[model samples]
Target: MAPPRNSAVKSARPVLAPLSIGNATPSNGGTPFRKPILTKAQRKAAPASGGIRRYQKSTELLIPKESFKRVVTSTVSDASKAHPMRIGKEALESLQEAAENRLVKTFEAAQLLAIHAKRQEIQQEDMKMIRRYQKSTELLIPAAPFERVVRELAQDLMSDILFTKDALKAIHVEAEDVLVKIFEKAQAFAIHAKRVTITDKDIQLAVKEILQ
Candidate 1:
């Protein structure tokens, strides 16, 4: 005998139903909230971006398998916290070193007189435009090294730039004044030592050796 005549018609396959927010029964034993009171216009407008008919056709979420794995991993890690990615000690040390280097560079940049007021030193290597960079952080000159340097350089911008012979002479003059005072004290010591031939050469050599 032939198959039943209606066998030509396709069998209706089971499909997952779209969730209904308004018509849903509460799963937590709480009484379901009454259906929303939507206006005719609102009812006609779709709550789902796609039609219910289209969503019914596809039960799979529109996400990649890799993306789903990432989502599941994050959620599981958050909930159970079973698997944790540990950063190695070496990696941590490297990161710390890199951070220190950057901080050093930043401090160095801040010490430039032109940039120090703004706490950013412009470097020719960086070729960063001075106009483009705005002063953000406090540009503090490094205290001991810069206190005397900035005070003396106020008279000349070039003093802050190139180390010219005149700039070195200015530094030498300052040093000479300090040395003169030191020499007077040394002379008093020298009298006690019974040495008068100990001239400025001895003083100069003594100063050089001591400083070195």
Candidate 2:
């Protein structure tokens, strides 16, 4: 005699085995995973995977060579002469490099001053104070004579632009102030390097330290 339909249907259903927790394998494969550990040196050398990265110094030149050369030519050129003074390629490069170094050093000193004051940004006051400090310690040059020279340099550099007496006077003051700051930084660089004389190389090194 045939079984009842309900009984047959119940019998046709397959039974599932109970899962073994201890011997269970991952769906990906039977292989167990382990993280690779790094050594102290390796860990130290590795870059951070997350969060803000530290600032890195750049090796590239900041100033444009053509513009620097134009300014240099204007400063050194004789107005009485018909033709402008010629600069050798090597001489131009050296001048540009030196100028860049001095500028970099000045910025570094200003930045340090800002940092010391718990400030994130450098201010004009910081620069002015630096100049004031330098001026206090150094022997004073006659302001009238120096300002006259500065006025001539400014006129030569920008012959097309007409400057008022007040503008020229401001320019003279600014130029003198900046030069004082730059000299202070250069002297600090020399002293830090344990040398009595401030060399072009010291200024170059100072720039490298800031931007390398």
Candidate 3:
């Protein structure tokens, strides 16, 4: 006798192994994002509701078995190789000896020392600039004169102190002075266009105009 086939009785679908995209390093909270592909069988056996059941289980570590190991190894090896170059014991000792013996600086040594010295000088100049502006503000004068003096001093100090690019500092000071003067007279500021670039001659003219 032949067995009766029923509409309700269905054969179990074959589960296919998953595939991985690319290998990447692991982190404290792994946030690997990938676009997954449905197996041929999985596509055909679509859920009645059509929602992906696999995604509901976990959002992390979804790579294929083979690439998972490779990713871990690659991350570790890369980190070790890229670690900072250490001055080894012998090299450190030699450098110390050279420093003690040589009165003249080598090119590399001179460059390093010069940069460090410049940074220190720049810091000191900034402090002095602040004090100079304080003095200008404290001087007994009308608000207009006080502001003009402060602006000029600040611009000159920015150049000497290296707080800003030297060329722009003068322009900044001059713009500030113009704005302050206009506000004092008109009770409102002129709509500022881009700053008019003052040259050495312009700076000389401004000082002569204000001081005289």
For each predicted model, how many residue pairs clash, with residues at least 3 apart or on different chains? Answer: 1, 0, 0
Local distance difference test values of all predictions, in order: 0.52, 0.69, 0.46
Indicate whether candidate 2 or candidate 3 has the larger lDDT. Answer: 2
Ten consecutive residues with minimal summed lDDT in candidate 2? 49-58
Among these predicted structures, which one has the highest lDDT? 2
Better of 1 and 3 by TM-score: 1
What is the model-wide C-alpha lDDT for candidate 3? 0.46
Lowest lDDT block of 10, candidate 1: 131-140
Better of 1 and 3 by lDDT: 1
How do the residues 1-212 of candidate 1 rate in per-residue lDDT, one tens digit apiece?
88765734554555565444555545544455556798987765545646655844875443454554565556656876665654455664554456555654453333333343443335553334332343433232333464466556765755455555566556656665567556655554554465654576557755765467
**Residue-wise C-alpha lDDT for candidate 2, range 86-193, written one tens digit per residue:** 889899898887888877767767877876788767999889977786567443566578767766776788877565778766666666666666666677787577
* Candidate 3 pairs with clashing backbones: none
Worst 10 residues of 3 by lDDT: 187-196
